[model samples]
Every structure is written in structure tokens, then in C-alpha cells.
Target: MVRVDRGLATTIGGAGVARVGYSGRILEAAADDPASGPCVGDWALVARWTDDRSTLEHLLPRRSCVTRAQSGGTSHAQALAANVTLAAVVVGLDQTPAITKIERLVALAWESGAQPLVLLTKADLAADAAEIAADVLTSAPGAEVMCCSCVDATGLSEVRDRLGDGTMALLGSSGAGKSSLVNALVGADVLATKEIRADGRGRHTSVRRELVVLPGGGCMIDTPGLRGVGLSGGEGIAATFADVDALAAQCRFNDCSHESEPGCAVLAAVEEGTLAVRRLESWRKLQREAAWVARRTDARLRAAELRVWKQRTKGSRGHPKRR
Candidate 1:
């Protein structure tokens, strides 16, 4: 699936790109759980009823998926891109880069089961781009980091080579130059571009998530600027904060909370200046959010099960068996 709207989807396959809708069963499933339906980058089987009509029949299992917790206090995971091999997290250096935001996106990418690549944009504008890149590297462990500029066309080739004919997804906030990066990669104005305001914030240019085919038949999904990136439950936290986890392993207690605990290795590192207090705090914040999300998800599952049990009991009481 390349695009998904209300009840319709567009698919790109060997047959070609065509718009399609969901089958009745699939629609029903989606109504209950949105993630059950088709998403962009999903390989699916489509059936054609007429020259102008088609329906998505079955969705193949996704090898990897990039998802985030749904906004507005929902306990559901919103799939950003499916079957993605690489997630390129774009950050602009025109202004002060938000390290916390970078950590969040890197965690999201790692949670997707895809390799995360951090691209610091606007390198030409920042003289200390390399220094900033080094700082970001500390936050994003196990992920490749690069500094690129679209103006002088620096590091674009390296980015392409890093992608290497695999499906990649662009993740960033507004004005991060994600669309501009896409245009440079495709060598044309394939996607729209806008100028940033005096305050250095970007306008919302790309309104939706769409997949653009790269030069060598590789796929890239360009996502709109994410304002509220709530994390879905996964081991991404551990992966992103591996440094913290490693210290926790050596704590006096196996379940050390790292908050004033006696003989806590994490606290020791913080006091010794080996670890940035900011990064440790970020880890604690994300861990709390993940725990809250897990509790909500478990509650939802239990409620669903109770509903089914009640329905079965009501049905059994409605009709007495005659022997």
C-alpha cells in the first residue's frame, strides 16, 4: 500500500499503481482495530472487480513496522510505515536541535525493527556541525549518524549509499527539510518546499505520508512533521538508552529504580560526571511513559476479553438447550 485514506487505499505492485478499497472482512477488522487494515509500504493482495474497482484482500506479514502511540490519550499504536528497512531521522541545525526529540525519534525507529540513521540537515548554516553531530551520537547509540546540506549537496551520496536500495522512511518535525531532501535525492522538485519563518520553524508542507520511488526502484516514505511523538510500547527504550541499562545491570538491587537507591551504578555514573544528567533524566521520563502506556494497553485487553465473556454468557442464557 502506498497511500491510505478513509476507506480507500492506493497500492503499488507489479500490476501497477491502483486505488483500492478494503474487503468487507478487512473493513470490519479495521473498524475494531485500525492497525489491522492496510498501511503504506504494506505488500497486499488486491482483487479487481471491474476496470475501475478494486479491493484489498489480504495483507502479507510485515517484516518491520514504524509506529507511534496514537495522540489524544488513545492506547493504540499508529503505524507510520510498514516493511521499512531504514528510518532516516532528519534534524535541522539552523536552530538549536532538540536532543530529547532526537532521542524519541531514534527510539521510535529502533522500536520499528529498522536501522536508524540520523541526518543532521543544514550543515552549511552551522559551522560546528561536526561537534553537534558528535553530541547527537551520544544520544543515539547503535544508529548511524551523518551531517548533510542540500545547498552544497554535501553527504547526499553517502546518504543514498547508506540506504542501499532498501525501503526507508523520513521522520522529523516541521521545517526539518525532509521534503527538500527528497527533492535533492530525486533530482527534481517532486515534492513541494517552503521557506522557514524568521523564528526558524518550518511550515507544514507535506500534509500526508506518501512513498516516493527513488532512482534505483528503492522506496522512501516522506512523513509529515510530527508534533506529538508519543511512543508505543517496545524494547526501543532499552535500545536507545543502552548506556543506562548497562549501568543498571551492575546496581546493587536487580530492580533498582536508579532514584537515590543505595549502590546504584547509574547514580554513581551521574555523580562522577560520566553520564549527562539530562540523558539520564530523559531515560527516566521515557521509561515512565512506556510503563503508563503498557498499563493502559493491558487494561484495554482485559476489558475486551470481559466483553466477549459477557456476550457468550448472555447468549447461553438466552437459549436453553433441550435434551
Candidate 2:
């Protein structure tokens, strides 16, 4: 990227930048700041660059955004990426793939207005990669699940068949060989990767969530390993866990938590083995986390909205607005 205006100028990168143009950050633009650098592959307002003017003027609007609940404070959804057309949930087959975790991430991706794909890597390590792939299909409906190993051309071919010429995000816990997969596909080890004990976990390699391009032609954004992804609480949550949510809707009380609730269809499904108990439990846990995030986000949003209204009210009443 060519340096321009300290941080307010424009960047001209090949391919990736050309495909997805620049837009400034939302929170920064909300505060009316001109220069906070463009938010990469995210929703932003874009303005024309004129000879007389140095800053952007109009917001192009975001196609979609991925977010998580505030980590520690009451804050609205933090935007992960904007205009993401596809999201690939990376799962390692070396160990039992947490279907729930995959679901939660998919939920976030769906919430962001992006279609989700499931990529199960490390077929060489998993006892039965094909079987696990089948299980993944059952766990997440309407998703493309691929079991692949970068060890050979066949596996690479399988993976290449899925990714299209669009922006796709790679999300999974570290050691899933996301970096390796990216390298193999690109026909080089351009991205850095490490190998630890296959059986053991706990080596923080990727720290920040940044976007990188796969060598071929498509682009991918690699994110830091997330221990948990909290949903922002909305239609996406219901859509991702439609099975559980549908059953919950059938309960006698709309406020049913599915725990000792009368006429709880969700619990009944668990009993009948129609829904895996573990899956139900996972859904419940995510619901709880989503609810928490919603509450915090609502609180944050309400505060900001109220402050805006308060300022207008004070200005109308001939009183100086409170700082």
C-alpha cells in the first residue's frame, strides 16, 4: 500500500484491493473523524478523492459484517469483516470436531450476511475423515463440508473445488493448519505455519485477525484462534440453530429455557434421540452466550441512542449539552 496522508490517504494494492475497495471504520466515521485508516474488507462509507478535498465524503454502505458480543463492556457488535461473500469454518479431524463450535461460528457467519462452508482439514491425521465429513453435514445443514489433507494433490484438488473467486474467511482454532492449507493452495509457503504435537494443543501462532489472499485468485481473511464466538442475538442465531429454535418455539411458554419447562419440544427431542443431547447442550450454551451479548449490546446501543436524543433535547431547550 502506498503511504498517503499519514493514514488518511488511499492504498492501491493489486487484485485483492481492486476486488474489494476501501471504506473507513464505522465507529470512527460515527464520531465524524476523517482519518482513521480504511477498514479492510469491512463495511465503510466511501467518498470520492478530489484534488481540493483530501478525505472521503460518502459511505458506500456494507454488504454485511461479522461481529461478536463485547468481550468485557457493554458494546454493540464489533465488526469483523464487511462484504464477505463466503465463510469457511475450519475444523481439524485429528481430534473429535466440536460440532457445536462449528455451528456457533457458522451462526456468526450467517449473521454477518455471508454463506458458510465447512472445511475439515487434516484428513491424514483423523482416524476416519470421510465419516467425520458425513457427521459435519448432519450437524450443519445447507453447508458444503469438505474433508481434505494438503499432503497430496488429490486433497488439494478437493479443497480447490470449493473455494470460488470471492472473499472467504478462514476461522478455526489454531493448529488446524489454516496457514498450511493457504500455502499449499497458493503453490508456495508464503504464509508462515508451525507444527506442534498433533495430540496436544496450546501454541498461539496467529495473534491478530487479518485478511490474506490465497495464491490462486480468491482472497481469504485469517483470524486469530477464537476460544469462543458469541452471537449478536438475532435472526442469524435462530437460523443457525433452526432445529433447536423451532422446538423451543413449540414450548408452552415463549420464555421457555428448555430446562424443566412444560411442553418443551426441545427437551422431548433430546429424549427421543432425534437431536443429539450433546448438540442440544451446545445449542443451549450458545444461546446463553448470545443472550449475554445481546444484553450488553442493547445496553451499549441504548446508551448511545439516548445520548444523541439527550443532546438534541438539551440543544432545543436552550441549555448547553452535557459533555
Indicate which candidate wins on lDDT.
1
The C-alpha stretches of model 2 lying farther than 4 A from their native spots are 1-27, 30-38, 43-59, 197-199, 214-216, 249-257, 261-263, 313-323
Q: Could you tell me the lDDT of residue 52 within candidate 1? A: 71
After superposing candidate 1, which stretches have Cα over 4 Å from the reference?
Answer: 318-323
The digit string of per-residue lDDT tens for model 1 on 99-153 reads: 9999999999999999998999989899999999999999998888999999998
Model 2 per-residue lDDT tens digits across residues 85-104:
77778887777887778888
Q: Give the C-alpha lDDT of model 2.
A: 0.67
> Scored by CA lDDT, what does every candidate get?
0.88, 0.67
Clash-forming residue pairs, model 2 = 42-82, 45-59, 46-60, 47-57
TM-score for predicted model 1 compared with the true structure = 0.95
RMSD of 2: 4.7
